[model samples]
Every structure is written in C-alpha cells, then in structure tokens.
Target chain A: MIQVENLTKHFGPVRAVDGIDFHVGEGEVVGFLGPNGAGKSTTIRMLTCFLPPTAGSARVAGYDIYRDSLQVRSQVGYLPETVPLYPEMRVREFLRFRAALKGVSPRKARNARVEEVMDLCGVREVARKLVGHISRGYRQRVGLAEALVAEPPILILDEPTSGLDPNQRRKVKDLVRRLGEKRTVLFSSHILAEVEQVCSRVIIIHQGRIVGEGTREELVHRLAGGRRLLVQADGPAAELQAFVGGLPGCSEPRITGSQGDFTRVEASLEGEEDPRVRIYTWARERGKLLKELALAEPTLEEIFARLTLSPAFQEGEAGEEESP
Target chain B: MKRVLVVALRELLAFFLSPMAYVIGFLFVFFRGWETLALAKSFADSGQDLNAFPMLYAMGLCGQMMAVLAPPLLTMRLFAEEKRTGSLELLMTAPVKDWEVVLGKWAASLVFFMVLWAPTVLLLLLLQAPWLLGAHLAAGPIFTVHLWVLLAGGLFLAVGLFCSSLTQNQLIASISALVIINLLLWGPFIVARAGWVPAEGIWRELFSQVYILDHIQSSFGLGLIDTAHVWFYLSTTALFLFLTVRSVESRRWV
Candidate 1:
C-alpha cells in the first residue's frame, strides 16, 4: 500500500536518502535492512510525513505524502525509532490520547480501541503505571500499543526491537509476524535473523540506495552466488587440505576453526557438485577419519555484509546522519 | 476541531497534573496578594484617594512586573519541551493539522494563565462588593481593569508561546520570552518619556499605538473601551500565535 518513486532527502550537501524507488504491496510483510547511518529512519520519516521529501515523492495508503499528508498520516501508524512518549502519562492515558489524536471516533470505539491495543500488545498489566517509571521492554510495548490504538491499515515501525532484551526481541518479532498477517508491515532493522524469520520480503539499503531486494532464497542464491561447504574432520590438517585442494571445481579450502579433536574448514564450491560425497570418499581412500561434513547456503547476514560493504556503496556511508 | 481538543486536553492534563504548575500558580497569587495588600495599606495610611484603587492595584509597577514574569513559567515548556523530547514528531505525524496543534497549545496556555490570575480578579471584585452594595462604586473602573488584564494576559502569554516555539531549550525559551515581553511591556513607557526626535510625530504615534502604559494600561484602567486598543492587543496576540504555527510547520523539513 506504499509507493515510493525516486524518493530522496538531503540535509545541506549531505544526501541522507538518495534517489530510490520501491513499492510495498498490500498485505506484504517487508523488512527494511540497513546498517547504522544508512538513511533508514530518514526514509521512514518521509513516508510518515514527519519530514517532507527534499525531492521526489511517496504515496502512503493511496494518499500523497506531501499533498495529502494528513490523510496519509491517518491511514498509517508509525512507531518512531526512539518511541517518544510523554513520561508523566500513564500507559492507558497515553494510548487514549493517541487514539484521539489519530481520529479514532465515537466515544465507545475510542475507548475500545485503546483497550484492544493494550491487550494486543500485552501492556494491560501496567496500564495504570506512569510511562516514565516502566522498564524499557514495557515502554517499547507501550509504544507499539500506541501505534495500534488507531487500528490503522498500514504500519511503519522504525527499529521495532532496538534496545530490548533477547526475550523481548523475540516477543516483538512474534508480534510483528502476527500483525503482518493482516496488515501491511514495513519495519526497519539491522538484525538479520529476526527479519529473516518474520518478513516475507526483504529490502537491503546502503548509502541511501536499495542495494538488494528479494526473498531470502533469491538473495542467497543470486547475490551470494554458489554454495559454501563446512567440513569438520578429525585427521591430519595437511592431508585434508591437500585432498580438498586437489578436488576439481573446489576453491582453496581454508581452515576456519579448531576445537577439541576436530578441525573445521570451509570452501566455496562451483556448479552442482556434491563436495561432501567427495570428501567422504577421499577420507575413506586415505584412511582418515571425517568428523563432520555439511553443505550450507550463504545466509542473509553474509549477503547483507557483502552487498553493503562493497566499495561502490561505501562512499557516502561514512558520514553521520545529518541534522534533518 | 475534535483533533484540536485532543491536543488541548493533553496540554491541560500535563499542566494541571504537574506540581510545578501549582507552584507557579501559588507564587503568582502570592505576589498579586502582596501587591494588593501593600498598595491598599499605603492608600489608607497616606490618606490618598481610594477612587484610584483599582488602577493603582492592577496597572501599577507591581502589576507590570508580575505581568512580565508570570507568563514565562506557564509557557516555557509548551513547545520547547516537545522539541527536546522528540514528541513533536509524533504530534506532526498525527492526523491533525499544524494550525490545530498550534491553536490547541495556545488555548491551553491561555487557560492556565487565566487560572493563575483568577483569584486576584475575584479578590478585587470581593473587595469592591461592599461598595457595590452601597451603590458608591461605579462598575466602569472594575470592568476596565478586568478587560485590560484579560487582554494583556492574552498578549503576553502569546509572546511567550512564540518564544517557546523558537527553541528546544526551556531556559532559553523562558529567558528569551522574558526579554521579548519586557521589550513589549516597557516600549511605550520608554518612548513617551524620552526627549528624543519629535514631540508629536510619526515615531511618537507609532510608539503610542503599542505603548501599554500610555494607551492600553491607562485607557483600559479608566473604563475607556477604545476599539483601536482592543484591536491592538488582539492583533498582537494573533500575530504571535501565527508565528508559533509557522515555526511548528517549518520543522517538517528538518
């Protein structure tokens, strides 16, 4: 339900979000992946109408971000990076205030909406407590509750689980996954595993541009190229390396780690070759013991690093987030 | 309009729930009470005319000092705190117009300013009740002083709101508001007493238009409902609120 075309933002001479084009279909759970200072927050601000675009345009929920900002804002619920809240207000009070601010009409419906979100985000226990005195995890959940209070059709959450503990992070991920089933979800994060688990589609941005975008398998197969081999053997390291080195279509096998009685080595294999079978056969012929042999596809984290760390994308990446 | 009320109500709660609001209110009341008591005692001791009571009590140096300082306390945190705490982003992204948020905040501060001075006005009316019972007190002076205070409060608080909108630092907002209100409050007095330039010309007329002492303070104190002075106070208030709206709107770019 969001369309961004050549969307760009600049702070003085610094280009925070360069010309970028992307679209998020309705009911799609899309993860926006980018490292720090990668213009993720800037992009979210533009879509939510908190910041006007310096150039180009974005349409959120079928409303122009610049021309019809109020309408777009009403249709989209945004949880900013820091979860800004009035600390003196109680959790329920803040959610009620947000419900009214977001145009949740009818006295009954407004109260119902507040209660529904409080229950949905699991903040009912601390509804009566002041927001400032709550723990960080509860505060984050309250922020989420505020976003859901209006029952908007679209959600744009910037770093939904930035500072939460591991358990809280898992809870937030589960919450996002559940919410994405019924609503269009676009959340930004630098965490790879959670995004892979929760999002159906992923967009990798670097230096204000989209460096990679696709499903997890597509990215791993396309951007990361062929498969990689992880071999843990209990034998002479020299013989293993020599054997793996002589195998055809296998690049140089490099020892990755050593622990206990096993030496782990990894190598990139070209084409549709079963290197594990060859390693086993070669080990049997050489009378050496093989402890482990497993083939693993490159993960999203590796692909993300490779795509973002390329020399082409590192030019504008070093600068800090500008004033805007 | 409902959206405006949402913002306004939140502000009201923020103000009334905080201990600092009550502290500021108590201080304002104490100052006005002391001013009234001390001025009344001076009039009775010196055998000065009692007819000048309301004028001296509400429009004298004491009143001027309180008017200059009281509004900053109510307005220092209005917009500056929102900016500093990053809640302004939440406000702008909500389904409310920029002007609605501005007007809501302005209305809430104006209400709090009224709450601060309500007791003082009530006390004056109470003191005059015996005279009114005797038909010895004309209502004109009381009405005039009341109008002047109301309009003056609106104008000064508007200036403070504008100053708060200009910065993210509460101290800076308060100090700048103090400086600005002082300039507005003391402008006409300085100009009228100065021996510079012309005795009666464009400069003098320009100062008189906004001169609170000679025009607003004096005219309204005598129960003279001058339309021009009323317009002057109202338009000044409107100008500051308009500036607050513009300042808030400009933040979306940054």
Candidate 2:
C-alpha cells in the first residue's frame, strides 16, 4: 500500500516531477502511463526512497518515506528501468546476494527464497550462467527475481518490459499480471496496450502532472466525447457526406474513403442515438446500395491521445474552459 | 553489522573475479620481489649485516609506490563502476545504510590489499632460510612494519574510495585519488627536503606531523608504537570514509 501527496521533485531548473498525488491500494495493480521524461521514473524513485521529494511527502506500508526510508524500502520490491546487475556474478549467486542484502534470514532460508524467486521469475534455467553472459530476457527475469527475493508486499517496477522483444514483453506482462494478484504493483510504461492488458487501474501522467486516472473502460468512456458511425455506400463521396451530415443528431460527417463506385462516410452522433434506421431509409430512397453501417469503438490509444495531446489537456484546466 | 558483512562479502567476491585485481597483484609481487633481491645483493656485496630485513622488505621504494598505485586501482571501480552501470540505484535503494556500503567496500579493498602482501610473508621467510645465512630477523620491528602497512593501506584505500564516490568515471576516480595520495605521501617530504620551512617553528611542527615517511621510519617502521601515528592513520581514514558516505548519500539529492 502506498499513499502520496503532492510529491514533487525538481532538478535545479527542471521540475522532473511536479506536484502530483495518487494512491495505490493493497492488492491492486496500478499502471503509471506516460511518455519518456514524463516524471514516471522520478515518482517511482521517490516512492522507493531512492530520491528525496523536493516539496511533498509519501508513505509506503504505513511508514513515512522521509523518516522511515529503510522500512519503506524493505516493504517494496523495486525493478529499476535498466535492470542494474553485477555482470560478474552468477545468476543464482546474484539472487542469493540480493536476498541476503534484503535481510531475508539465516543462510538456509535466504538460499531457499532465492531459489523460489528464481523459479517464479523463470530464471532457473540460467541460474548458473554469468549475468553478463545471459540474454536480455533472462537478465530482466533475474532482476524480477532479485526484487521478489524478499517477498515484499509492494512492487514498484519502472518499465519492466522495456527494451524486450514482443515475446519477452508478453511474458513479463503476464508475470506482472500474475504477481499482482497478491501484491500491490505500480508499473510505469509508455505502452498503453501493456497497461490495458495488465493493469486494473491506469493513471496517465504528462509533463510531470497527472492528466487522467481511472480504469481502462472508464477512461475511454469519459474522454471519448461521442459515438461515431461508419457507413459505406455506393454513391458519390460529396453527396454521401452531405446526406450523412444532414441526418438528425449527426455532425461533422466526412467522406473517409472511396473506391470504384463505393464511398465510406463517418459522422459523430449525440448521446443515446442510433441513426441506422434513418440512414437505411435515406439510402433506400436514394436508390443507393448500402454496404456497411456500424458504430465505431474507441480504443485506449485514442483516448490516451485525446487526454495527453489535445489542446484542452495541454493547457490543463485552462483549455477546459474553452472546450464545449 | 550483518548488512555490512553481506555487502563486504559481495564486494570481495567481485574483486576476486575481476582481471584487474590479478594484474595489480602480479605486478605488486613481481616488483617487490625484484626490489628485495637487489637489496639482498647489495647487502651481500658490501659485507654488511642484514639486521634491516623488515625495513628493506616492507618500507622499500617499490613497496611505497605500490601502496600509492594499487589502492586507487583497487578502489576506483568500487563506486565508480556501480554508478556507471546504474547498479548504484539498486544498491542505494536496498535496505542497507550508506555507511554500511561505504565501510563494506573500504573493508573489502583493504582485505585485498593485505592479500596482495601475503606473498611477502613467504619472501620474509625465504630471507631467513639457511642458504641466506639464516639471519635472525627482529620479530618486534617486523610486526610493527606489517601493522604500518595495514594502517597506511587502509588510509590510502579510504581516500581512493572517497574519490571513486565523487565520479562515475573510473579513470577520473583513479587519477584524482593518485593526485591526492601523492600530495599526502610525497608533498611533505618534498617540502622539507627543499628547506622551505623554518627549522623549528609551527610550520615545521605541522610538516612533521604530516610527514608520513618520518612517521613510518621513525615510529611504526621501528619497534615503537606511537599512538599519535596510529591515530593519524585511523582518524584520517575515518574522515575519508565519512566523506565517502556523504558523497554516496548526496547522489539522491543530485
């Protein structure tokens, strides 16, 4: 469990993490979504007590990050972005060292925990190889095992799937998903799909501030203003666009594509309205063959783009006043 | 204390696995052996007594130079390489304290420093062999010289670790440590030899206090256990270790 309040970090003239607030409850997997240099890593570092917050405070596992950094660190398992490791150490030896460093227990218990996490992270096969000699995927899995060696209840992984191939990414994502079933996981990523598939709740941060926070469907529904209709008919592009634009509750109808005698048209509709009947009647009266008619579903990527890149979100609350 | 040992053990393991440690160790043994043979040849040719066995072996120019050179090489990678490879993040975030990390690394390097000198123990034995006249070496002075070697190496290794903590560049760490160690070791000797300070004044007293060569030969190198010299080595070593811990903690703020 983690509670943060107005956590801020400034590197001289640059505000790496501006005033931001968020909470991660126990046994919940929260995805921290942001682009590069978006204060995601900075916030995670602060939570792990690796960096002291410049202005605000945070607490982990009921311990204050400033006064109880050691306790806070002990309570959380951290996988840093680059997955730092001693190249000379063997994989199993490195995990044992990490386990001891985390104060696992007597030698026997430490080795057992190390072995368990090594298996949990799927690093058992490469346990004897030198860390430098292993592939990147195993190195990442080793990093994960190192984090889990102590069996900390909270997991703070910064870009756990970064720099991995698609297969490795999928594997790591599944691992995180399974691990999150029992522990609180706060993982940062620029990949929306990864977060969508793995996290139950997502927080979008941009320019050092939180832009949006909710479940995937909640974010999509809240930010994607209206429903869209896609209609394909055998007609002139301009005429089809005009006809769709003239429909009740329809606006911004545009010709999206055309081929041979078929043309595709799209339009945004107001709430709770299905204009398929009206469009079918119009097409029948105009002697036009209607090929397709359906409402388009908005993806998380589109909702993220609207929240992060739109001028309304750019000026933050200031641009909200200008938006209808 | 347990955390400190854990960190120290890991560092010791890393040191043993590194090629640089072997290269430095081989050079130290090779050059020290060469110097000891030359000293033995000169004593034999002049028909002089070899009562100065410990001083020749332990306080020789080659031994002194290695003290200055090997520490920086051993400690340069202690913190600098961790920073360069981003391992310092995981290390700092671990449950261990900053002082634990600093002390652990310094202790490991000091242990390696002592290990590098282990072959000299055998060389000391070989000097007392029957073919070499079975010279009766004074054990008291020999013990003092070995103690001085440990204390002096501890201080220099602390300085090197401090320098390593200041930068991520291993070359810069080694070069800076070398400069500082040279200033501490040779600076007073050069000044006093040049006759720049008054013969009997506060400046001379100050120079005498810091003159490590004088301390080694006149006190620790002999059978005398000067608490002042011991305190000098210990207090300065502590000062550097403290500074290294502060430097490590400062990384979080930066």
Candidate 3:
C-alpha cells in the first residue's frame, strides 16, 4: 500500500536518502535491511510524512505524502527508531493521548482500542506505571502499543527490536509476524536473523540505495551460487583438501578450522546432490576417518555481508566521513 | 479544532501533574498577596483614598515584574523539551496539523497563566468584600485591569513559545524569552524617556503606540478598553504564534 518513486532527502549537502524506488504491496511484510547510517530511518520518515523529501515523491495508503500528508499520516502508524515517548505520562494515558492525536474517535472505541493494543503488545501489566519508570523492554512495547492504538492499516516500524533482550526480541518478532498477517508492515533492521525469521520479502539498502531485494531463499541462491558442505576429518590437511576437492560436483575445499589432529574444511557444491554419503563412503574406502560430513545452508548473514560490504560501499562510507 | 483541544489537554495535564507548576503558583500567590497587603498598608498610613488602589496594584512595579518573569518559565518547556527528548517526532507525525500543536501548547500555557493569576485576583477582590470592612470597589476597573493582565500575559507567553521553538535547550529558550519579554515590556518606555526619537512627530506617535507603560497606566489601568491597545496585544500575540507555527513546520525541512 506504499509507493515510493525516486525519493531523496538531503540534510544540507549530505544525502541521507538518495533517489530510491520501491513499492510494498498490500499485506506484504517487507523487511528494510540496512546497516546504521544507510538511510533506512530517513526513508521511513519520508514515507510517514515526518520528513519531507528533498526531491521526488511518495504515496502512502493511496494518499500523496506531500499534498495529502494528513491522510497518509492517519493511514500509517510509525514507530521511530528511538521510540520517543513522554516520560511523565502513564502508559495507558499516553496511548489514550496518542489515540486522540491520531483522530481515534467515539471516545469509547478509542479506549477500547487502546486496551486491545495494550493486550496485543503485552503491555497491560505496565499500563498503570509512568513511562519513564518502566524498563526498556516495556518502553519498546509501549511504543508498539501506541502505534497500534489507532488501528491504522499500515505500519512503518524502524528497528522495532533493536535494543531488546533475546526473549523480548523474540516476543516482538512474533508480534510483528502476527500483526503483518492483517496489515502491511515495513520494518527496518540490521539484524539478519530477525529479518530472516519475520519478513516475507527483503529489500537490502546500502548507502541510500537498494543494493539487493528478494525472498531469503532467492537471495541466498542468487548470491551464494551453490550449497556449502562442512567437513571435519582427522587426517593430513593438504591431502584431505585434495581428496574433497576431487569429488564430483565439489569445488576446491578450503580449510576453515582445526582441533588437535581433526581439521574442519568447507567445500562448495555445484549441483543439487547429497554429497554427504559419497564423502563418507569414499573416506572409508581410502582408510581415512570422517569425523563429520554435513550439508549446511548458507546463512542470510553471509549473503548480507557479501551484498553490503562491497569495496565501493566501503570507499563511499570513508569518503562521506571525510567530506564534512 | 478537536485535535487542537486534544493536544492542549495533554499539555494541561502535564502542567498540573508536575510539582513545578504548584511551586510557581504558591510563590506567585504568596508574593503577590504580600505586595498587595504592603501596598494597602502604605496607602492607609498616608491617608490616601482607596480609589487609586486597583490602578496601582494592576499597573504597579510588582505586577509588571511578575508578567515579565512568570511566562517564560511556564512556556520554556513547551517545545524545547519535546525537541530534546525527541517526542516532537511523535507529535508532528500524528494526524494533527502543525498549527494545532502550536495553538494547543499556547492555549495550555495561557490556561496555566490564568491559573496563576486566579488566586491573586481573588485575593484582590476579597479585600473589597463587605465582611473585610473594606471600601466599596468598582467592578469595571478591576475587570479591565485583569483583562489587560491576560492579554499581556498571552503576548509574553507567545513570545516564550516562539523562542522555545527555535532551540532544543530549555535554558536557552527561557533566557531568550526573558530577554525578549523584558524588551517588549520596557523597551519603548526606555527609548521614549531617553528621547532617542524626535519629541513631536510621527516617530514619537509610533513610540506612544508601542509603549506598553502608556497602554497599562493610561488605558487599562484606568479601566479604558482602548481598541488600539487591545489590537496591539492580539496582533502581536498572533504574530509570535504564527512565527512559532512556522518554526515548528521548518523542522521537517532541516
């Protein structure tokens, strides 16, 4: 329900968000993956009408971000990166206030919606406490509750689980998954695992531009090119590498780690085939012990690093820092 | 309008819940009461009539001093604190209009300003009650004088709100507002008294028009509702508030 076309934002001469184009379909859970200072927050801010883009335009929920900002804002609920909240207000009271500020009406429905989101976000226990007195986990959940209070059709959450403990992170991830089932969700994060688990589609942004975009499997298969085999054997390292490299559909093996006489090596496999059985059978025939032989899936982390850490991206980051 | 009231109600609730507002209210009542009683004692000792009482009390040095000092303190945190804490992002992204946020804050501060003045005005009125064995008081001058206070206080608070919008530092906001209020309240009087402008010309007439002391002492202090002075307070308050709204809008740009 969001359309962005050639959107750019500049803080003076620093281009926080360069010209970028992307669209999020209705009910699609899109993960905006980018490292810090990659313009993720700036893009979300422009979409939410929090910051006007320096050039280009966007339409959120069928409303122009510039000409119909109020309509777009009413349709979208945004949780900023830092989760800004009034410290003096109680959680319930704060949500109620946000409800009103978002034009939640009938008073009774507003209160009911606030209560519902409080329960949905698991913030009912801390509802009576002052926001400042609550822990960070509670604060983050309260920020989520505030966004859901108005029952908007679209959600733009910027790093929703950035500072939470593992348990809290899982809880928020699950909540986001559940929320995305009914509403369009565009969440940004640098955490590869979280995005891998939560988002249906991933868009990787680097240096204010979209560097990679696809499903997790598509990205892995496209960038990784082949499957990986993790092999551990108690044998001479050079001979073991030569043997594994000579196998069918297996490329040259690289020694990855070691423990005593056991050497851990990883080999890239070319075609769709189970090489585990072949490796084990061949090692037994050759009078060599195979400690471990398993096919391992390439992780999103590796793919993300390969895509985002290009030499050009690093040089651009260095140049940006040195310019001003 | 409804959204404006919603924003205003939140700000009003914050002020009431803070200990600082109570402290300010107590200090204002205590000091203004003491000053009133002290002035009354002086008048009685000199055998001067009570007819000049409301005029002196309303346009007196202490009233003007409080006017200059209290509003900046009340309005300093209105925008600056929000900016510092990053809550302005949440506030601005809401479905409400920019002017609504500005007006809501200004409205809340104006309400609290009235709250601060209520007890003092009640005390002054109480002194005129029959049970206190006090003189018969004319209602017109008393009402007009307090109206002047409200208008002048509104202008001062608007200036403070504008200053608060320009920075994220609360101290800077309060200090700058104090400077501007002091200048607005006393600048014309000082310039005219020092004969900086020509004595008899359009420049001198313009000085008189802008002179707050003349507006207070000759107009509001004597219960005359000079439309020019009323327009002056209103238009200046609007000007500052409009500037504040612009300042708030400028946040999206930079």
Candidate 4:
C-alpha cells in the first residue's frame, strides 16, 4: 500500500531523510526501527504529507505523494509521534471532529464511525471524559482512535507505544497486530522488543537511511554466522577459556565476565553443531563444573548493531538494496 | 463549504466555553454604555438638544473599542494555539484545502465578534427607550450608525485573524494584531499631521481620507451607505483572508 522511492528530505544543511526507499505490502505490519535522529519521524512525515520532500518521490496507494497529496492524505491515517490532541475536547467530541475533518459525511455515520473506532481502541468507557483529564496511556489510545476515525486503509503510527505501561503497550501492540491482518501498518519505534513482538517484517534505519530490512529470522540468519553459544563455568576463567577454544568448531573463547563462582564465556562456532553437549561432557570429565551453556541465537538488536556499524552499510543503498 | 461550517461550529463552541469571549463582550458593553451616559449628561448640563450627533459619537467610540480590543483577544489563538499544541499537522495533512481552513477560521472569529456585538443591539434598544416611552423625545439615527460600527468590527476581526496566522506565539499574535489595527485606525491622523501626502485634490483624496477610521467615521457616523466604503472593508477582509491561506499553505512546504 506504500511505495517510497529515492525519498530524501533535507532540512537546510542536514538531510533528515536521505534517499531511502521501502515498501509495505497490503496487510503487512512493517516496523521502522531507528535510534533518535535517525530520520524515522521525518520519513513518516514525508509519507503523511505533513512535510514535503526536498527531492525524490513517493506513492501511497498508487497516488503520487507530490502530485496527489490530498488523495494520499485521505487514504492514510497518521498518528504523529507526540499524539497531538485538543485537551479541552472530550474523547467522543474529538473523534467526531476528526471524522468531520477527514471528510466523513452524514452526521450520524460520522458519530457511528467515531464510536466504532473508540470501541476498537478500547476507549469507549471514557469517551465522555475530556482528553486532558485522561492518563497518558488512555490519551495514546484516544490518539489512535482519532486516526482510525476516518477508517483510512493505511495506518502510519510513530511511536505508538512510547509512554504506555507494559499492559497498555501489549494492548496497543495486539490491536496493531489485529489491524494489520487486513490493512497496511507502518510504525516507527526505537523499542526493538516491541517491533519484534508485533512486526512481521522490520526495517532498521540509522543516520537518515534504512540499514537493513527483512523478516526477523531472515535478518538473524543473514547477519549471524549460524551456531553461536554462551558458556558459564564454575572454574578458573583462564582454564575455561582455553578448553572452549581448543574444542572443534569453536572459535577463540572470550571471557565475558565473572559472576560469583562462575565465569561467562562467549564463542562463535564454525558450523551448525551440538557443541553444548560436547562442552558439557568435557567439563565434567576434566572436573571443571559447568554452570550454564546455552546457544546464542542472533537477535534483531544484534543485527541492527552489525548493519549500522559495518563500513559496507553505505547510505545510498541502505534502503533499496533488499526486499522480502 | 461543509468543512468551513464544521470548523466554524467548533470555533464558535470554543468561544462560548472560554472566558475571553465574555470578557471582550463585557468590555464592549461597558465602554459603549459609559460613553452614551457621559454624552447624555453633557447634553443635560449644557442645556442642548440630544440629537443623532451624540449617538454617532458613541458609535465612533464603539468602532475604536473594537479596533483596539477585539482583534487581539479574538485572533490570538487562531493558528498559534494549534501550532503550540501540534494539531496543525493534523489539520494541514487532512484532505481539506488550505483556503477552506483559512476561511473557516476567519469566519469563526468574525462570527464570535458578531455574537459579542449582539448585546449591543439591546443597548441600541435601550437608547431608543426615551423615544418609545415619551412623545416629546426625538428618535436618533443610532441604529443605522451602529450597523457601520459592526461592519468595521468585522473588518478588524478579519485583519486580526490574518495577523494571528502569521505567528505561533499567542502574545506576539495579539501584539501584532493590536499594532496593525492601530495603524489602520490612526494612520490618516498621523499622515495628515506629518503632511506626508500632497494636500491637493486627487492626491489628498487618495491618501488622506483612505484610512479605515476616516471611512468608517464618515460612512457609519453620518448614517450614509457608501458602496466604496463597504467594498473597502470587504476587500481588506478578503486580502487578509487570502494572505492567511497562503501562510497556512507555506507551512506544509517548510
């Protein structure tokens, strides 16, 4: 539902969103993961038509962003990073206002749509309360409801669960996941775990460019060299490191740290192997106690770090180089 | 047109809920009342006839009151509050056109100012009490004169809305509106004293009596319906509203 090509937005001397390109298919929930000042919000703003791009082009639902901004805006629902709202307005009143602003016709239908979205976001009980009187979590929910009041096909939410508690965050995440079942969802967030939990695919961005984009498993397999392990031993740190280093398929072991009587070791295996059992048996025979041994699968956070830190991850090809 | 009405309705509702509208309305009534009562006392003390001139003078005072006071309070939050609260993004990104938003906001403030003038209609009615109750008292042309004042008040509100759209700081918006309104109201007096424009026929006509206050005082104060004067107020309103639309649209690009 969204196609961005060579999209670059420059703010005077600083390129806030440098020539990045990506697309989210219909009914796909794609998480935009980036650190602060990584151009996530800028990209979303350009897509939402709040800020015009300095160069390049984008298309939303087949409407050119530059040529058909009104159509693009009408087709998408945007929840800004700050969750702007009128504090004096009640939840229902605010949603009604948003519905009217979004061009919803027939007053009764507008109110019904507002009610539906409010109920969908689980904010129907407090619909009568002024937004200013509500808690942050509820206010975020209200913001979401306002965005959905128009019933736009695509949703662009920036930091949707930024300030919510764990339960509220889970509720919003689940709601987004459910919504993504039938609509396109593009959300930007700095929280890696939140993205991993709800996003079917992830796009990692840094310094105004997308560094990597793929499914969680695909990214882990691509970035990580298969089997890796972390071993903790109740023995001398040097002895544990030397023994693990000498094992087959195990690279040089690095002493992670010492906790109580146990020493932590991180080592990369050469190939897919059940090296944990062999390490355990060797430690038991040598009279060196093994406290814990677990295979370390690559995580989104690690992939993100590797992509951003690698010298090969150039800015120009960061976003457009991959798809899936 | 629907978007305009929706925005207008929301703004009007906000005006009734807020205290600023009430304060402006109360000040308008109090000042006009004081001026009328003072004129009545002066006529009584001098043993002169109470005529349309006294009511005209009071109407002029009303025009000055709105010119100085109404604009700042009414237009201070036109675009400033939205920018401050970050709702400008939502409005700008919506499908509604820029001109629609500008016109809607301008019309809303103008409507609020007009509602504030509603109480003045009662004041006009009260001013006609003597003529209605007593046979010896003469009716004055205050009603017609006050209509001109209302027109001038609408112009001020429109100009104020434009000024408010220029800035995101409420204090700055209010102060800018006050300065622009003052310049338009007193500009002729300053130019006449300084002799900046030629005191000849066409030049004098073009520059001297073209000030808002001069036209308003002449047309409304004398109960005269001049098409030029009406067009002047309307054109000024349209120009400001157009500028407001451009300013709002430029924000999307910036």
Sort order, TM-score high to low: 2, 3, 1, 4
Q: Please tell me which model should have the higher TM-score, number 1 or number 3.
A: 3
Report lDDT per candidate. Answer: 0.83, 0.88, 0.87, 0.80
Specify the poorest-scoring 10-residue window by lDDT in model 3 chain B.
Answer: B129-138
Among the numbered candidates, top DockQ falls to: 3
TM-score of the second chain of model 2 compared to its true counterpart? 0.94
Per-model i-RMS: 1.6, 1.4, 1.5, 1.5
Sequence-dependent TM-score of model 2:
0.93
Instruction: Tell me the tens digit of each residue's lDDT in model 3 across A191-231.
Output: 99999999999988888877777798776665544478889
Best by TM-score: 2
TM-score, chain B, predicted structure 4: 0.88
For residues B21-133, what per-residue lDDT tens digits would candidate 1 score against the true structure? 89878877777777776776676567666667667766766567667777887888989999999988888888999899988987888787777778886667655654322
- The lDDT, on a scale of 0 to 1, for candidate 3 is 0.87
> What does candidate 2's lDDT look like per residue over B54-108, in tens digits?
6666778889888899999999999999999999999988898999999999999
Candidate 2 colliding pairs: none
The digit string of per-residue lDDT tens for model 4 on A2-118 reads: 999889988889989988888899989999998889999999988988888998889999998878999999999989999888778888888898899889989989888988998
Q: What fnat does each of the candidate structures reach? A: 0.73, 0.80, 0.77, 0.64
Q: What is the lDDT of residue A314 in candidate 4?
A: 47
